[model samples]
Every structure is written in C-alpha cells, then in structure tokens.
Target: MASSAFSAAKIVGLTGAAWLSGTIAAISLISIPAVSRTLKEDNLSAAHAVKLWRNNFEAGFALAPPIALATASSLASCGWAARNLRTSGVKDGRLFWVAAALTVSIVPYTIIFMKSTNDKLLRYAKKEKLTTSESQETEGLLKRWVFLNSVRSLLPLAGALLTSIVVLA
Candidate 1:
C-alpha cells in the first residue's frame, strides 16, 4: 500500500468512480420508464411541459460545470505527474485521471444522489424553489446521469485489465 494520504486519495477517488459509474449506468438504463410514467400522453403542451423539461435540464446544467471541473483537474493532474515522475504526488497517466475523478466527483455525485434534501439544488433553483415535488419529476433525469456515470466506472476497470494482461501474460 502507498502512504496514508496517497492511498486514501486513491481509494476515495476509485470508490467515487465506482459509485458514480454504477449510479450513472443505472440511471441511463431506467430513464425511459420514468418519462412514460410522468406524461401519460406523449403530447405535452409547451407551457405545461416546459417547467418539467427545464427542471431536468437545470439538473443537467448543474452537473455540467462540475463535470468540466472534474475532467480538467484529472487531466491536469495527469499531465503534471507526467512531467514530475520523481514526485510523491499523483502518479502519471490514467491513474491520475482516475484518482482525480474520484476525489472530485464526491460533492457533485452526492448532490445528485441525496435527493432527500434539495438545499444545494434549491439554493440555485430558479423561479420556484426545489420543492419535494421535484424529486418525483426529476428521478428519471438523475437516473440517466447515473447510467452515464457507469460507463466511467467501466473505463478504469478496462484499463486495469489491459495493464494486468500485459504484465502477467
């Protein structure tokens, strides 16, 4: 095992990736039924449905900045590690991305998962507040996000598998 800080960061990051990926994948898989349940009739008047669409869109929009930040941090960390191989900070290459992704995803992922409270989203929710009613309306949207996150989980696992094959074969 690496030193305490190093290992802890790695574990925190990897755990976040696994969780984010799993939840994203689950969301992506189950989004359709959610839509159907919400609008029994396919045809939604613009005024009636706009709020719902925007709410979900707001959820995604909320996520975008964090995703951008997380990706940037991971990529930047990887680049720095590559330049300074002797340092005891983050290691080089995808490991850096993975670790950074994990460490960074914590708050954003938590915000999405912990629908029990909307204080975070509500703080930013425009127009009407993030009422408890929003949870039911937004579950599918959040689920889709989680499903996409699953793909992220799979990527690191794939990288590790390939590395193992090369070393042990």
Candidate 2:
C-alpha cells in the first residue's frame, strides 16, 4: 500500500498535469481562434490582433511554466517515494518519472519548436507600419502558432495519461 504522502503527491501531480493540458488546449482551441476571427471576421486592425495575442501570451507565460515545474516536481517526488517504498513485486512508479519528463518537456518544445513563430509574431507586433505582405503573413503566423501550441498541449496530456494508467494499475 502506498503511504499517505505518496498518495497525496500522486493526486497533486495528476491533477496538475490534467489542468496544465486543459489550459493549453483551451488557449489553442478557444482563445487563439477567437483572436484570429478578430482579424478575419471582424476586420480588426493588426495592432488589435497583436494586443490580444500579447494579452494571451502574457497570461500564459505567467501561468504555464510555474504549473509545469510544480507538476513535474510532484511527479518526481512520487517516483522517488514509490521506488523507495516498494515492498513486493508490483509495478513501480518509474512511469511517474516519465510523466515528469513529459510534463516539463513543453519548456524545451516551446523554446525550440515555437520560438521562431513567436519571434516573428513579436517582431510584427513591434512594427509601426506593416507592409501588405506582412499583414497577410500575420494570419499565417497565428495559424502556425495555434498548430504548434496544439501539439505542445499534448505533452502534458500524455503525462497525465501515463500517470493515470500507473495509478490505476
């Protein structure tokens, strides 16, 4: 039987992973699409689109990394405790470590995969006057970001799924 502390950590880690995944999914599915609609349907200005994107980015930046670190930390703790506390032949918490790795992998994924799109968007946001081509490119960049973020969201969700299987097993 797992100790109370290990049980608590498992709960925390699993919940955190689920929450993180859901949050990112919401941003990709709901928030970004709405902002994109502002550009197309509403015929809003580039500055308005950039402002909305910046708002979402700032909020996500403030929220996501800390949650990732906390979830990964909790998962790592569960892994350590499970490894040390095993008494008989049973599945250990090694998967928890993998979950931790997946949950935190979003950091590098963002830095590597999403950085170029993010940089381009930021550059566009800063420009005082966008050329007609640059304005057209904004839509493409936003679409690319949505796709990248959708992929990034899967990482934490996979972590959460792995954690769930291990716990239920």
RMSD of each: 9.8, 2.0
Q: Which candidate is the best by lDDT?
A: 2
Please give the lDDT score for candidate 2. Answer: 0.88
Instruction: After the best TM-score superposition of candidate 2, give how far the Cα of residue 130 lies from its true spot, in angstroms.
Output: 2.4
**Which candidate's TM-score is highest?**
2
Candidate 2 versus truth, CA RMSD in Å, comes to 2.0
Q: For candidate 1, what is the lDDT?
A: 0.43
Quantify all predictions' global Cα lDDT against the true fold.
Answer: 0.43, 0.88
C-alpha TM-scores of all predictions = 0.39, 0.93
Model 2 collision count = 0
Clashes of each: 10, 0
